[model samples]
Target: MVLPISRFWYKFSLFLACLLVFWAGFYPEWVEKYYAQAFYPHWSRTLRFLLGNIPFSLGDLVYGLALLLLFWAIGRMGRDWGRMGFRSASWLWLGKILHALLWVYLLFSLCWGLLYVRPSLGTRWQLKPVAYQKEDIRRLTLSLLDSTRKYRQRLGTEAVWRPCRDSLVPWTLSAYAPLALAQRTPALDQASLKPSLFGAVGDWVGYTGYFNPFTGEGQYRADLPFVLQPFVALHETAHQLGYAPEDEASWVAYTAALNHPSDRVRYSAHLELLGYALAEEFLLYGQEGSFAAFDSIAKENKARMDPGVRADRKRIRDFFLSRQNQVSPAMNALYDQYLKLNRQEKGLRSYHAVLSWALAHQN
Candidate 1:
């Protein structure tokens, strides 16, 4: 049912899509002006308006149905291979599979994937890129470390907040208020943000939050520590705002959370960015001597953290480590490939590029 095209038409459509993708690569400004700024806002707004009040994640439901359909197709093709012979079945199903993929890619691109080709967030904002050194990263790490401790101190020991959707939604929206006002972009006055239906599975699979581009909804794991939820939610919402790349979403979210009025939200943002800053700083230390020596240096660096910060970080680390399984690495590898295919040159490493943008902004 998905393929309403003849074989010739399917090939033609695929050819057109390839051409469009090639054109998009060369004309990022055009995509930014027409698609990201003009078309995507109206399209995403309509989707949010239609889907926002739903009590559950319609996006998750869509994914579930899609998986079922995939399984059904595989089963049907297997049956066809027995009945119609290998060559005949291959001829039949391969074309169908290609057609299905074409439809999926087209829908994905029209809905959200084309945002991948839009101008970089820095270019969009006209921020001058700074040539940062190891010292800049070290200073940023120290600054973030100090702020994280201060904010964590403010929250005291009672950091566990209930995932009250009512307040959480507004908290994230309000974080974007100043940016929305300044940019005069689409108003995220309403949201289709939800706790992901796949929360438990997501913990093992490793994602705190994601935006469902197909359904125009932002989803976060409700079971995440309160400290992690605010920034995760804001990051997902950044996707809904049409910042497609991981680093772009993170940079936008970090900047927004920094402007947030709540100490908890600001603390959450700084704490996570501190980790990124530290990781970048660690790379500066490089591989000095043996693994044992590097491990010693790592431990020494961590030993400098505030006691409460160390404990909290350990709790967060242990939470994920306990849930991790054999599947996590394979899933992560797949996602890394997915990012690379989407034009993120650093793949998973793109998430850490927020530190570079932050450093640029600082300079």
Candidate 2:
């Protein structure tokens, strides 16, 4: 007979996942306060410490075994189809998969999904200092351009260009020391960032990195250009630290990376934020001020950018553009829907909202 234990837990886990969904949906306001006060800080630190010092990913092994188990289960059901009876074998294995899925969802929700309901970092920081005008954006852009030039010269060779390929874990950890950690909470300091198991998959999908709520691991795509890795890793780690919304996380990541200990990493952060600032400047001041701001980039800064960094810029552009064909419309639609469901009304454009947040810090 099929084991009764498998069937019971499968159904029970699904029930709990559904219950948590509705409970969170209806009472996110309450969850925000309660989770922040009673659960989040302690829970995040506990998970962080559990595997933070391991140097390798515990989540990776768990995932590898899960994939192997999936294949084994599929084969077992096929092999037993006649002896166990088709109906019985099918239910036993299918129920096992469903049980695993339910438990995964339940774990994910408890660990990270509730963070989506938390108040934005904006509210925490109170960014109402928008009185500064377009001149501020231009000034910041020039400063970032100047900073970017200095770092490019500091990073003289391509030796550092191949960061993720050479194992970026140490540099990633080191980059965190200069952060203006907004909460001032002590537990966040215990958290550490690591590389992801699915780093290859990240390259294929244009994923920079993602915070694995399952194991509280911060992993970045292993194939990103060396310059982009530090800030992207920090951004994903912001999620692990309970900053849920993309824009809010971007703001924190930008703040942290712009002030990072490594000069090269600081320039990389500014470079990323430059694109955002340029976009906003164009919107606010139109082509005139925008081009004028570009003109303001120091001649030495412009001259310092040789062909290699230009190639890196081209490579970064092509990375996303080339991946567009692989990403089906259905996937895009699904992500757009997911963002919308999460109150991201601007959908994917919400990521760009960090520009406004960046400009806010200038004054």
Candidate 3:
């Protein structure tokens, strides 16, 4: 009687696992926000950091060993089950199905959390700027950099990146940082900056710094111009840090790169933001004057964009838009749902909305 009860429970577990796998694939947003914040956020930052990050790094080694044992067990089980006729074969089949369902659940959970929950939580706690002004931008940028410098003094030079990365979250808290500190802050208008041309046709650059959502590990094109690389790197790093919303990631990346001590890094942040401002102006205003301003900035950028950089951008563009790219409309829709679930009113399109906030506060 006890053995029969145990078998029933095992079968029920497998059934529930299959249901969750199906739900996760079809309606990931349903689980993204509430689950992460409710379960994962209560832990101390140190504990969360250890469990989410450190364990994964170590888990890779164990995973290798586990795979070896898994293969051995499967081989042995296949031979043994083959001789047991239908009764044992059915149990083995059930076990295999249960294992597949569990794998799917884990994959869906990670993707949903990374693309939805991380951004929502980070944005919810993001520091909002109290004021906006050119001088304020300059002051805040400098102040943030000073704070990072102090952090480095305590942690040593090797720990410099931590301060730099941490500074990004607070840098875009207000309009002041964008207006005062950025070296070439451009005026925003539809004519000067427009929505990405690719976006007009439902195509997107999708060049985020994070790994592929499904596989959770894959290299992306890294051929952007040096002037743009640092900011892009920081933006992608923001995604890796679990800030999935595009606007938040952009702002965070801008702040990180700007606060970095390296001149090149600062320049990269400024240039990337300037490009967005110009793009926004072209799309929204389309005024001749705004276009003129954009042309001037573009010429300046062109002079700076060396032959190698141009070639690299082209290569990267090709790679991002190629058939091998893994993005899909369903994925975009999933992102949209998650955005709404996280309280972003505009959904996935909110990425472009950051320009409004940037422009309204521009010095």
Best by TM-score: 1
Q: Residue-wise lDDT of candidate 1 within 1-363, one digit each (tens)? A: 364569668588686986786578678899889998889999998988999889789998899899999999999999999999999999999888877877788778889999999977777687755567767987787788788878877787576344545567888889988889889335787877898898887956688888998999998888887778888888888999899999888888898888788887898888889889878777866634457755765685676677777777888888888888888888899899999999998899989888888988887
Question: Candidate 3's residue-wise lDDT over 1-363, tens digit each?
Answer: 245888888767766766664554445354444444443333222222443333122323334565787798777778767788767877877777667657655655544443453334323444442333333333333333343333334433233222243233233222223432542221111110111112212234243333333322212233322334445555644444345566766775665554555654554455455445435444433444577765654575455444433443455456546633345666677878866865577887676555444433442
Model 1: residue 359 alpha-carbon error in angstroms? 0.5
Best by lDDT: 1
TM-score comparison, 1 vs 3, better candidate: 1
Give the TM-score ranking, best first: 1, 2, 3
**Candidate 3's TM-score:** 0.43
Clashing residue pairs found in predicted model 2: none
Off by over 4 Å in 1: 1-18, 160-165, 288-304
Q: What is the TM-score of each candidate against the true structure?
A: 0.92, 0.72, 0.43
RMSD after Cα superposition, model 1: 2.9
Error of 2 at 141 (Å): 4.8
Q: What tens digits encode model 2's per-residue C-alpha lDDT throughout 1-363?
A: 554998778677678766876577567667777786588777878888788888767777777788898889778778989789989888877866776766766777787777777666666677742544567776766666666667766776574365553334454555555453444222355655666666666544446776777888877666666778877876877787678778888877777666566766676677787666656656666545566655544343356445445565677788766666555556666767777877778777778777667667765
